[model samples]
Target: MSIDQHGDHVLQGMSIRKLPKVSLHDHLDGGVRPATIVELADQVGLEVPEDTADDLADWIAERSDSGSLVEYLKTFDLTVGVMQTREGLTRVAREFVEDLAADGVIYGEVRWAPEQHLSGGLSLEEVVEAVQDGIEEGEDAAEQAGHDIRVGQLITAMRHTDRSLEIARLAVEWRERGAVGFDIAGPEDGFLPSRHREAFDYLASEFFPVTVHAGEAAGLDSIRSALLDGRALRLGHGVRIAEDLDVVSRAGDEVLVQFGDLARWVRDREIPLELSPSSNLQTGAISAWGEELADHPFDLLYQLGFSVTVNVDNRTMSRTSLTRELALLAETFEYDLDDLEVFQLNAAAGAFLPVEEREELIELIGEGFER
Candidate 1:
C-alpha cells in the first residue's frame, strides 16, 4: 500500500500505474514538459527563470502550490509563452500524449485555448492542425512502444474575453478533424457560463458537446448557470456543489445528509464532477471541506451516487499524473482496487467520446482491472 517515488502504489498486489485509465479534464497548455519548455523557449529566445528542466519543474510546482489562483496562474505564462509556434505547440501536444500513455491512459481529451497560441502569427486553424499532427504522432509512437492510446481536442476559450463564439466555431469547424468538445477556461468567479450565451446557443444548435469550468472558483449560482444557460454536459472541478448539502449527522461508517434543490438536481441527474485532488487542495477549491486530500468531498459525492471522476487538471503545474492522482486518493481514502476501477469507469462515462467508444473504454477498463 506504499506509493513509490513515481507516485505508483500497489493495491491488491497490483500496480496502479498498470491500470487502464481515462483522462477528461487534462489541459494541454498546463501539461507541457519542463524540458520541452526550456528547449522551445531557447529556440524562441524567451528567457526562462530556471535554466535546467528539473529546476523549471520545481519552480512551477512551487508557484502553483501558493494556494491562490492568481499566483498559481502565473506559472502558465511561462508554459504558454513557449507554446506560440507550430513547432512548440506540436512538440508540447505530442509529449503531453506520450506522458499520458506512459501513465497508462488509454484515452484522453486535451483542452487548450487556440486564441492564446496565435501570438506566433499562426491562424486558428493552423494551431488546431499542429496539435492534431502531434497527437497522431504520439499515438503512433505509443503504439510502437506497445501502448495503445487515443486523444482528442477539447477546444477552449478564455472566459474573460469576447472570443468565445469564435472559439466555438473553430471547435465545430474541426469537429471531424480532431475536436471532440468545447470548454471555457480562465478566471471563474465573476465570469459565468451565461456570459457566453451566444456561443453556448450556437453549440446547442449544432448539437456539439460542451463542458464548463464552473463550481471551482464560484458556487451554486455558477453551477446553476452552467446547466441552465450553457447546457454543460459535465462540470469542471464541480466540487463546490457540496456547499449545497447540509451534513445533518454522521457516525462510524454512516452519515445523514440533507440536499438543497441545486444539489439534488446535480446529484439526481448524475452530472460528472472532475475532481482533481492536488489541484483542488492547492487552489482551495475544497477549503471548506478541509486542507488535505482526506477532506475532499470526492468520497462524499461518490457515496451519494454522484458521477465523481478523478483528474489531473494540470499535470506539470501540480507535478502529478493520472496515476499519481489516483494513488494519492487511494492512500488518503484507503481505497481498494475496486474503488480505483470505479473512478476510471466514471471518467470513461464522462468522456466526450461517442457512446460506442465510451462503452469500449469501459470494457477495456473492466478487462484491465480483472487482469
Candidate 2:
C-alpha cells in the first residue's frame, strides 16, 4: 500500500481516487487553492508572505504543521484576508466544490464563518448568498464535466464571538436554499458550546442539523458540552473521545477495553466521530496516543463499534484531500478495499441529508466500491 506522487493509492487493484466519497468536516476558507490565493491577493493588493503560488503553498503547509491548535488556526487569517470581497467569496466557494468533485467527492458539506468576511462591506446575508451562488455554479460546472456532485453549507459562528444566536438564525433561514447545518468554530479550550446555549436552543427548536467542533482542541469535557448544550448530531474531529477508553489488553486484532460512561453513550448512540488524520496529528488532537498517524485512535474506536468517519478537516492547511487522507490511513493501517468502503459508508450514514438521500448515497458508494 504505497501512495503515489499524486496522493493516490492502488489497493486491491483499484485506484482510490476513482471511488465515490463523502466529505463532512471540510472548511471553506481553509481549502482555498494557493494559486487562487495569490491571484485573489493580487486583485485586492494584499501583501502575501510568499509571491509565487508554490512558495505560498509551502509557507502555509509549514506554518500549519505546527502542533499547537492556535498556531494551526493562524494560517486562516491569510485565507480570510483574501476572502473579504463578494467576488472572492464566490470564487473560493465555487472552486471549493469543483475541487471536491475532482477528488471524487459526490457529497460534501463546506463550513465557513460569514462574519469573518464582512470587512469588504458585505452583510451576513450577502455573503451567504454569494457563497450559495458559487456553490450552484460549481455544481453546474461539475455536472458539465461529467461529475455529479452536491454541496451544502454548514453556516458556522466563531465561538469566541457573541453573535452565535444571529448566526443560528442565518443558518436556518438558508436551510431551504443551500444551508444544511450549523456549527461553532474557533478556539475551543475556553469557549465551550455551553457559552452558546441560546443559539443551540434555537437551532434545536427549529430542528436544524448541528455538528460541533469538539474533542479536537479540547478534551472530553468539551465534547460533553457539545452534546449536552449544543445537541450536536455529529462531532467535528471528535478524536479525543479515545481518552475515555481504558485499554486493558490487546493482542493482534483483538483487544479488551473498559469504556467510560461518555464513551459508552457515544458509541451506543452511533454518533459519528469526524476524525481527520494529518490535521489531528498536526493539532495535537491525538498526541496523548502517540505522535504518528498509526497512533491515532480511529482504528480503536472503529474496532469498538464507534461510527468513525474519515475527514480532511482542512485541505490546503493540511495539504491533503479525502483521497490522500484515505490513502495515508490505508497505508498506515494496512486496510483493504472492504475497509475503505466501510469508511465511505460511515460518512454517507453521517451526512446531514435526508434519509432517502443518505440511502441513495449509500447505494452509490456500494455500487462504486463493488466495481
Best by lDDT: 2
lDDT for predicted candidate 1 compared with the true structure: 0.91
Each prediction's TM-score versus the true structure:
0.98, 0.98
Model 2, 281-354: lDDT tens per residue? Answer: 99998889899999999889988999989998999999888889889988888888899899899999999999
Candidate 1 runs further than 4 Å off: 1-5
Deviation of model 1 at 338, angstroms? 0.8
- Candidate 1 at residue 29, lDDT? 88
Write one digit per residue (lDDT tens) for candidate 1, span 156-268: 99999999999999999999999999999999989999999999999999999999999987888889999999999999899999999999999988989999998899888
**RMSD, one per candidate, in order:** 1.2, 1.1
